[model samples]
Target: MAARLTRWAIFSVAVSLIPLIFSFIYLTTVGPTPAFFDLISDGELLLISVALTGAAIGEVIDKKTARIKSRLASGGGCFLVASLSSSYFVVVSAQDDVRKEIVMGMSCALLLLGVISAGLAMAASEGEEGG
Candidate 1:
């Protein structure tokens, strides 16, 4: 049970991060945009990483992934916070409109990722105690 839960938590991370990573790559390097490396490895990614860590903690801490997931099953603003911040940067910093959308979209995806992250953490924590 614990192992299954851990698998799910990791699966969640992989599942969520895939869009983020891909969109991030696509958005920042679709055209004659600035440096792709620069955009992808900037503050936005850093924020996502940190926030995801927190979210992961939240999920596993409760000793039951299902429990945390249940609480956040039908929630809002999953990626709104991250998207807003990322959008701001994308609009202001990204000159190309296409790239901007990609960046913004990536942020939005990451926002969702952040939301699920907490649940993952809670689930992991629950599994730790053999719950």
Candidate 2:
């Protein structure tokens, strides 16, 4: 169960990071994606992913190095930076469309996933607690 939860947390993190590159490609080539989608692909989602990763690492600190937590957090932050980069063109290209809202919505969804994943990871890390 712990391993399963850890996998799930990592999966969520991966899913959140995907928007950074995928959304950019979709928006650039497909001509104006939704804001909700854009948001899902941004730093906010990545931040949440990072926070969750930190928590997961914290849970496992007894078996691993403490530095891994900070490192993974930085990795999430890097994803955030990548996601934010898409904003440069997205803002100027789609002004009056529903792009912003959709992107923001997506970002929130990714964030939600990240938070939930973090909780699960933290919970799973408790060696004595066998869920």
Candidate 3:
């Protein structure tokens, strides 16, 4: 399980970096534009959310000590918190006023999903310890 988790983490990190690399290349080739930058930012945020969720899932599957599990849960919680803030900022910074409400609504839904994933990870960890 631990090995599988490690592999997953590595894969996720690699996948997350692809957009960043592309964004850098795009910025260097074609002058920066607000819309383009915003699109890249949104893509990055979505990738980050996926990576964090992957980490949480990995931690839950890993057969680690209770202390490690607790730490992993806390770390996942922190990531979710950061993601929530970033999502809110994305919605605020969006240029389309009409879509702002929709973006905010989606952000709230993602936040709820993050919270649920974290809760599940923690619960799974606890269950492993027969607690």
Candidate 4:
């Protein structure tokens, strides 16, 4: 689970950061634009990705002590928080309509992932109790 989550976190980090980096560079080189504002506003997602990746790293390094179900539950909760933040960005950021729609879709995807992770944690807990 730790490995899997770490992979997921890494992928998400790439997804969030790659565009951010390119956009930031473009903003710096080209001048002020809506993309720059979008980058500034959407920056929190990078932090969230880093934090979740850190949590996964901790689990991987401390495998002997970390509880799998708890880790999954917490990871799921973090995802929910991130999803909420993204949703807020969609509503608050004055980004273009197309980008706003993209953010909305990302929020929904995050919400789905959170629910799935939470469900997996619950299933794991049940298995532990039953056996």
Q: What lDDT tens digits, residue by residue, belong to model 3 across residues 5-121? A: 455446754565577678777866787543434444343444455555656656655646556756576556646655665666565566555354455455446645654564455
Best by TM-score: 3
lDDT of 1 at 72: 50
Pick the winner on TM-score between candidates 1 and 2: 2
lDDT of 4 by residue, 1-131 (tens): 45544555466544545766876787778875544346544434534443443444343334434466665665555555545655565564555544654664554455455434433433233323221
How far is each candidate from the true structure, as Cα RMSD in Å? Answer: 8.6, 10.7, 8.5, 9.9
Candidate 3's C-alpha runs over 4 A off are 31-47, 54-87, 95-131
TM-score (C-alpha) between model 4 and the true structure: 0.36
What are the per-residue Cα lDDT tens digits for candidate 2 across 68-104? 5554554454345334433533553456554555556
**For model 3, which pairs clash?**
none
Steric clash count of candidate 3 = 0
- lDDT of candidate 3 at residue 127, scale 0 to 100: 40
Worst 10 residues of 4 by lDDT: 122-131
Ranking by lDDT: 3, 2, 1, 4
- Which residue runs does candidate 1 get wrong by more than 4 Å? 5-10, 32-36, 64-130
